[model samples]
Target: MIDLHAHSTRSDGRLTPGALVARAAEAGVTTFALTDHDTIDGLDEARTAANTHDITFIDGVEVSVTWQRRTLHVVGLAFDRGNAALTEGLATLQQVRRDRAKRIAAKIEKLGVADAWSRAQALAAAGQITRPHFARLLIEDGVCRNNNQAFKKHLRPGRDAHVTVEWASLDDAVAWIQGAGGIAVLAHPFGYGFSAAWRRRALAAFAQAGGDALEICTGTTDRQQEITAARDAAQHGLAGSAGSDFHAPEQFWLGLGRLRALPGGLPAVWHDPRFPGADAAN
Candidate 1:
């Protein structure tokens, strides 16, 4: 199986990097990428574990991008993790995420929650603090039942705990990925709740800004959406990529490489020989 997007405790995920790779291997994921949110701290560990488990490990990261004042994710695949430009770009995002987490915790505190920031810190440990950590806090407080409910009730935009933070522009993010010798893919377009026309505009802009691919098969996308995404990506001259976007085992809607085949007749982002095991994955 080919799974180009996944997370680890290096970001908001539940498992550690090594454990994440082991889990994916158990799930029959042959080609995998550790696309941790805004950080590559887990890549080295995940790569080591992938080697041990005889899995194809792709160096990847999920960048947070603000396009038209809305936060979206861009997946950087087969990148040079040591590339200075990519590392520096991700560093800035790391700080932005930390600040956002603190702001969210402050808001939660204002709602009479005690020691919100410290408790969130304890939950995160050395990992990057994210909204999921906050969601766990909400779950613990009995404010919500799960991550989805936490978002719907309080953490999502237009909610009490939501604090908007400026993220990297789409152009800057795509540039950084390209600089790292990576392909930039728009991740899970349908997950953003954009109408068809709006999605087209976003795909057009992404392709115009040098994005190379868009995810067609993903945990959040259905069969019809996959077909539409493939058609849209072809129209925009972008390739089709697929991934599970797996974060945690408890996430009911996500799994390791559980996506269907990429829509036929579309270019694949990993067709290039530079990405190891590309032939086998196809």
Candidate 2:
């Protein structure tokens, strides 16, 4: 199977890079991409593990972008991970993430949580700090019953701790991915909760901004949505991509290599010349 999006401990994922890749190989994933969020630090280790396991590894990163006032993710696959421009841009984004985490901690502290920043940092353990770390801390501190409760009470948008920060624009994100010899794919279009008309508009803008593909099948098993996404991508002259968006092993439905195949007759992102032989399964 071909799975184009996943994460490791380099970001918010539970598994380490090597472990994630090893699991993918064991699960029969022939082509795998470790598209960790806002960072490529795990790619080198993941590539090494993939080599050992005889699996094809693609250098990938999931860049967060702000479009029409909503945060969206763009997955860049087969990129030059060491390209100077891409690295510089990602550095800027990492700084933004750090600053946002601090702001969120301060906001939640005002709501009676003490030393949230330090606690969350401790939980991160040298990895990049993310909202999930804070949520875990909240659950540990008895502030919330679970991760979902933490988000509903403090971290979700418009909540007390939600701090809005401008991320890279869609055009700039697509440019960086293209500049680094990668294809920019709209990651999990259905996850955005946009209305049907709004979804079309966003897809149009993404295509105009040089996005090359749409995620026709993500972690979800909603066949109707997958078909609709594939049809829309084809209508917009964009290629189709699929991923499990796997993060933790507990999310059984989204286990590595478990995604349904992309709808028949849709052009595949892996079919590009840059990824020769990757489309063999398709």
lDDT of 1 by residue, 1-282 (tens): 788988898898899999999999999998899998999999989999999999989999999999988778999998888899899999999999888888999998776667899999998887888888888888888777788898897888999999998999999999999998888999999988888788888888899898999999998788998998899988988888998888888877778988899888997887855566667766
TM-score for candidate 1, residues paired by index: 0.96
lDDT of each: 0.89, 0.89
lDDT of 2: 0.89
| Residues 1-282, model 2: lDDT tens digits | 888999888888889999999999989998999998889998889999999998888999999999999989999999887888899999999999999999999987877678989887877775788888888877877888998899998999999889899999999999999999899999998888889898888899999998999998888849999999998999899999999999889887678888888899998999987664655745
Shift of residue 216 alpha carbon in model 1, Å:
0.7
